[model samples]
Target: MPSKKIVKTSNAKKSQKQTKRDLKKRNKKITIKKDNFLKEKFLSSTANLLIKAVSIAANAAIVNREVGKRLNRRGKEALTIVSQLAVDVRNDVKQGVRAAKKIQAKKNGLKNSSKTRVRRLSA
Candidate 1:
C-alpha cells in the first residue's frame, strides 16, 4: 500500500493572505502610535530645558544685583570711617597747637599777663 500526500487547497491560501494583511495593518498602527509618543516626549523635554535656562538666567541676575549692593554698602562704610578719622586728627592738631603756644608764653616770663595777651591773639 502507498501513503497518500496531503495537499494545500485554495481556501488555505486565501486565509493566509488575509492573515498577512491583518498583521501589516496592526504593525502600521503600532508604528504610528510610537512615533506620536516619541514626538510628544521630545517636545516636553525641550520645553523643560527652555524653562530651566530662563530660571538660571534670572537667578544669575539676582546674584549679580546682590553683589553690587554689597559692594556699595562696603564702600560707603569705608568712606564714613575715613572721614571720622580725619575729623579726629584735625581736632588733635588744634589741641597740640594751643598747648605749644601756652608753653612758649610761660618761657617768655609772662605768666599772668600772657593769659590776656594769648586770649587776644587767639581771638
Candidate 2:
C-alpha cells in the first residue's frame, strides 16, 4: 500500500488573488472615506459661515432701513449700528478664512501654530 498527498493548486491561487483584491478594495475604501469626511466637514463649515454672514447682513440692512425710517430722530444711531454690524460681519468672514487656512496647512503636513502665525502676520 502507498500513501499519497494531494494539493489543491486552484483553490490556493484563488484564495491568494481574492486576498489581494480584498486588500486593494479596503485601501480604496479608506481613501474614499477620508476624502468624503474632509469634504463634508469643509462644506458644513462653509455653509455655516455663509449663513451667518447673510443673516448678519440682512438683519443690519433691515434694521437700518425700517427703524431709521420710523425713528426719524435716530438716523445717526441707525447708521452707527449698521456700521458696527458691517464690521462684525467682516470679522466673521476673516475668522472663517483663518479657519480654512489652518485646516489646509494641517492637511499639507505643516505645523499649525507656526504656519498660522506666519500667515496671520503677513496678512
Candidate 3:
C-alpha cells in the first residue's frame, strides 16, 4: 500500500482573491476620505474668502463716505474764501477810482485859477 499526499491549491487561490478584495476596499475608502476632506476644505476656504471680501467692501464704502464728507466741507470752505476775495477786490477797485477822481478835480481847479490870473494881467 502507497501513501499519497494531496495538496490544497484551491485554498491558496481563495486566500489570494480575498486579500485582493480587501486591498481594493481599503483603497476605495481612503480615496473617499481624501475627497471628502478636500471638499470640506475648499468649501470652508471659499466661505472665508467671501466673508473677507464682504467686510473689505463694507469698510471701503464707509471710508469713501467719510472722504466725500470731508471733501464737501473743504470745497465749501474754499468757495467761501474765493467769494470773500472777490468782494475785497471789488472794494479795492472802487476806492482806487474815487481817489483818482479827487486828484483830477484838484488839477482842473488849479488850471482854472491860472487862466483867470493871466486874463486879469492882460486886461
Backbone atom clashes (below 3 Å) for every candidate: 0, 0, 0
Local distance difference test, candidate 1: 0.91
Give the alpha carbon lDDT tens digit for every residue of 1-123 in model 2: 697788768988999999999999999999999999999999999999999999999999999988878787577788999999999999999999999998887777666677888999999
Model 3 lDDT at residue 61 = 99
For 18-98, candidate 3 gives per-residue lDDT tens digits of 999999999999999999999999999999999999999999999999999999999999999999999999999999999
Model 3: CA > 4 A from native = 1-16, 120-123
Model 2, runs deviating above 4 Å: 1-10, 74-123
lDDT of each: 0.91, 0.92, 0.95
Which residue window of length 10 is worst by lDDT in model 3? Answer: 1-10
State in Å the error of residue 26, model 2.
2.0
lDDT of 3 at 70: 100
Candidate 3 local Cα displacement, residue 32, angstroms: 2.6
Residue 88 CA displacement from its true place in model 2, Å: 45
Q: What is the TM-score of each candidate against the true structure?
A: 0.52, 0.44, 0.72
Kindly report which residue pairs in candidate 2 clash with one another: none
Model 1, 1-97: lDDT tens digits are 7988877679889999999999999999999989999999999999999999999999999998999899999999999999999999999999999
Ranking by TM-score: 3, 1, 2
Candidate with maximal TM-score: 3
